[model samples]
Target chain A: MINSPERVAPDTLARVQAEIERLGFRPSRAAQSLKQERAGAWGLELNSAGFGRLGAILDTFLIELTTGAAERGSHVVPFTAADSAEPLPAYERLVASRVADGFVLTDTRRDDPRPAWLEAHRVPYAAFGRVWDDPGITSWVDVDGASGVDAAVRHLADQGYERIGYLGWPEGSPVGDDRRSGWVRATTDLGLAHPEWQATSTQSLPAACRAAAGLLDQLGLPGRSARPGRPGRSGPGVAIVCASDALALGAWRVLVERGLEPGVDVGLVCFDDTDIAEALDLSSLHQPLDRVAERVLHLLATGPDSRDPAGGLLLPPELVVRSSSKPAGNRTTRKEK
Target chain B: MINSPERVAPDTLARVQAEIERLGFRPSRAAQSLKQERAGAWGLELNSAGFGRLGAILDTFLIELTTGAAERGSHVVPFTAADSAEPLPAYERLVASRVADGFVLTDTRRDDPRPAWLEAHRVPYAAFGRVWDDPGITSWVDVDGASGVDAAVRHLADQGYERIGYLGWPEGSPVGDDRRSGWVRATTDLGLAHPEWQATSTQSLPAACRAAAGLLDQLGLPGRSARPGRPGRSGPGVAIVCASDALALGAWRVLVERGLEPGVDVGLVCFDDTDIAEALDLSSLHQPLDRVAERVLHLLATGPDSRDPAGGLLLPPELVVRSSSKPAGNRTTRKEK
Candidate 1:
């Protein structure tokens, strides 16, 4: 009845569309692939360096993406680096060999040569991360890291933690920079910006712990005065936000070693809600990789011919509030033995 | 020089052959593939159930295998389950479509229908796990879990831990059963067999922790006694072996909660030397996944034409000795706060 143009009114059409959107109706991809002669696979070009120490976010994302692809009656064809410096040959071969219908590019950076190469060759691709320079070249799906961190910082402030600190990766890393930029935005907006409180380190548990310890030690000293008109509230309610779960885990350990209660004395927010966070019951920003995969698959299936200029989708991350971020006296905060 | 039959003496040829064997020369796969008209891609059929949790072993193996394949100028084509119970359609399509030269099978079980299906269809395939029904049906590369656990048990006994318990997954898992068999063999041989001391639980950290605590509390109470020859040792030296790193991590936490110092009052050994083992400094059995990948790739490249009766390779696992396996007197173990 809804499909009949003669009987269905404009309001009925709108209501049906709204219901479909609310219910998240995805068309059967197996049937769609059969109808369109789809290759039923998408190629993913992985960085060789990532294989050394598998990133938890990337590992989980891959699993979710594979599940998403399998649900859609498709699969992800992984192609690794032949030459790390020059990966164009492998990309060219993938196109020439017809192994996959399209590609999904991950770990996108500023001035990334991949989008250019893909544009020049007119290969169908959907990037998982955004490129800085020619946004019109390809469709992409990126988690709004800046917004995620911005929300995380605000949440910390709302938890009554005034002296919030941030631990992030070193400069020049686009991904880390994006996350830090969010913290910057939040700190500035909240009137809690502390230049001495910010720190950077390599993305390892040990390195992050050291950096976090340095930040915490330097945070609540005599030289660091309380805010104007707000005495005796300088650093007792300190909070720390990390760019990743690894850094947060490190900070948690440092806090424990320093005899400061994590959830009561210091609020902690971690990006990437991996298994570690779950095990430790830490608050974290969870990226919706399943939705991202769905959107990326949609763009890839649309192909290059139908490429739209404003096709980039920036999805918001959900904040999972656990015991780690609860304010003092909150029953949700679990006591450490 | 050995190529020249007329100029080279027989003794010289023999010496050169011995040197070549010592050097461990592997022929370039690119040249071999070119001469043989290789499809340049291998198929991997992944189960949907495995995708749910994304086992760390499988994840690492995939990365290593993909890297190995890329180094050999080939790529892995992963075809996942469209139907969980019936995966042959996907395999049949891969063959009918000529998208892959051969397949690599993982997580093989008793009376697995896949081997028989491939055999009847004349599809070239190599398994990563052993098939119990007929060893001669196909080539396989398996990690010797029995030997790995046997070595772990002996190492614990050597560490002055007389009563070594095993925490493993519930019955019906082949891999878990294999590891338990090793423990049983070692316990029976060492006269420390206590049937009630063994416990089984789910593979999660919390479940394993609860199970570990139960085993520890129920042990050495009344019924369980020290080995007949060892009258001096009662319950002084107690240790545990886990089937995986997750379980080991749980056991460590339980030990800590009970105020017992790990690597001091208790010994721990985990299988799969993943990041957790390194981060926690627990001793583990490291599987030779790189070598396994090498052997699997070799069998795949050989195709079904060169199927040998005794082609199965069961590689022994290497146990890495760390502070966790060290005896109480050893000062090498780092003291926890």
Candidate 2:
């Protein structure tokens, strides 16, 4: 009678409504969920490797996702899989118990079991990374790493850095390869391609530093030049475009050790404008995480069946320039190369 | 009858159990929650400031909390307040709607409204940081920052660093002050007290670098000494104990710019062994996040009504000795003073 006011007499409806307002009555979410057969919550699998690290943007994405869910009168239930490699059991448990209406997937990689399993079970899910194994899958939103890296290279070129080197993760990872392609495309477009100027290393700082050192030597940085006899590449107008902030930190450390100022000596740019970049004053590409989160939640809300025909969205990252990418004329440090 | 097998006839129960097993039917969490008047979920408010930074440990804590909650058959529902300062409304909404049975609070500070508001409303909540305003409130589990800093100082001192200085945040924050007190206590205890050999800055890199330079100068580190006349403190056997990895990065940068290799030239130790510390190989205090999460879950499970007679728990962080704090004899870099 309270819900269907039309079934009750006008006087009774008014009295009951007034009493409810006076007593501050509110419906229980669990009871409502049961009646509607919806959990009103989304499961988010927290794979430890995705967050809690340098240059990690997933933590920021989580904040955006949580904030967005709240605005839509929903909650994000974070859970960890017992076995990260075999996460289907965790997903299945949530589904069986009806603890979540759907899931928000992240760290989507090649040959990942999640998308295929979720699809087979008719589970509603949306990923923050591309559905790498299946281009047919459209329930995802990701940053355009290739374009972001391309922009970084172009930005470095514009800053008067002639010999631009690339520092990136070893090939084979989809995301790393995608970002590397951008550097390739940008340098080729500018007719300044120096393929040998690049070097690869794992995400570790020591490894990054070693790779960066070798790359610097290849680019004809004085004192440690690997090919000192080679001509035309030796100069102060050199810059390095790194795939991640962690890699850029390695390059930055090499510059500091050589008593060379980053912007004043060698221009530097990196992807993922994380705290490391901000702290060290390095120019980096900033992913549109808020928009990505909004799109992901949209995909989750309007299941994969109702996804857009255009397929997964790839938003371009914005380049955040700091002192590291500034022209040499604006030198602040007194270090002489 | 399915749940209480003994209440039914043996034949009927056997048949029902077989059918249930065949169908793999499980009790709906939402329906169960409605019946029991429990949400079986804990709310975690993710303030942007607490995580996603150079020296943040909250992200790690979140992962640990999520894993611990899952083990206890509970979900951690992450949410964001419309106004972080007045977050009671968000908590109230969760309570009134029965979305969560309790909350796991983080970033608890003095004069925080959540503790008082939750206590008055009789809401079950446990904080990751101490309830600084009310000593009687014992629903928290915190890393003992003072003890952690004290250990770092002693560790640096043990590594043969004679002129030990501190780089910390500006005074007023309870956590910052606690850590600073540790430095003071340890330095005084070891008869190496140099009250003026310290500097404070906000958690920004540039500010930290400036402050660290000043502290290093006061400690008589080479050419930049503030008082050239001051005799006893000049040389390579100096070290800095930073309150956080972020601050340590700043000090590290200053040291790098002056061509001084860490460990070989100056010992360094910091708190919150975050990725920044790991990347730079800085020795730091690692908070027992897994243990902290376990304890926080325990507090939330055992509500304030049946709380322990003892006060809130303070777990000490372990000092992770990396290359940054090694003795000067292990010199790798060829830089000369």
State in Å the error of residue A272, model 2. 1.1
User: Model 2 reaches what TM-score against the true structure?
Assistant: 0.94
In the range A1-337, model 1's lDDT, one tens digit per residue, is: 4437568788888898799799755453333333454546678876745533423666556656666776665677787766767877877765554556678888787767788888886777888888777756559888989999999999888888788889999989888999999998999998998867888988666677778878887776221122232124334588889998778867876665454556776789988787667766789999898888888888877777886667688998999988788865666535543
What tens-digit string does per-residue lDDT give for candidate 2 at A1-337?
6678899989999999999999888899998999999899889988887888778888898999999988888889888899999999999999999999889999999999999999998889999999999999999999999999998888888878888999999999999999999999999999989899999998888899899988988887854243233223335488899999999999999888776678777889999898888888888999999999899899988876788889999999999988888775654663322
Q: By summed lDDT, which 10 consecutive residues of candidate 1 chain B come out lowest?
A: B221-230
B1-337 in candidate 1: lDDT tens per residue?
A: 5446668888888887888789754343333333454546778865645532312666667776787887777778776666757778778766654456678888788767888898897778888888767867658889999999999999898888877888888988888899899999988888878766778877666677778878777655211132222122335588888888778877776665454556776788989887767666689999998899988998877777786657688999999987787865866645442
Candidate 1, residue A79: Cα displacement in angstroms equals: 1.9
Q: Candidate 2: list runs displaced more than 4 Å.
A: A222-236, A330-337, B222-236, B330-337
For model 1, the local distance difference test gives 0.74
What does candidate 2's lDDT look like per residue over B10-36, in tens digits? 999889889999999999999899999
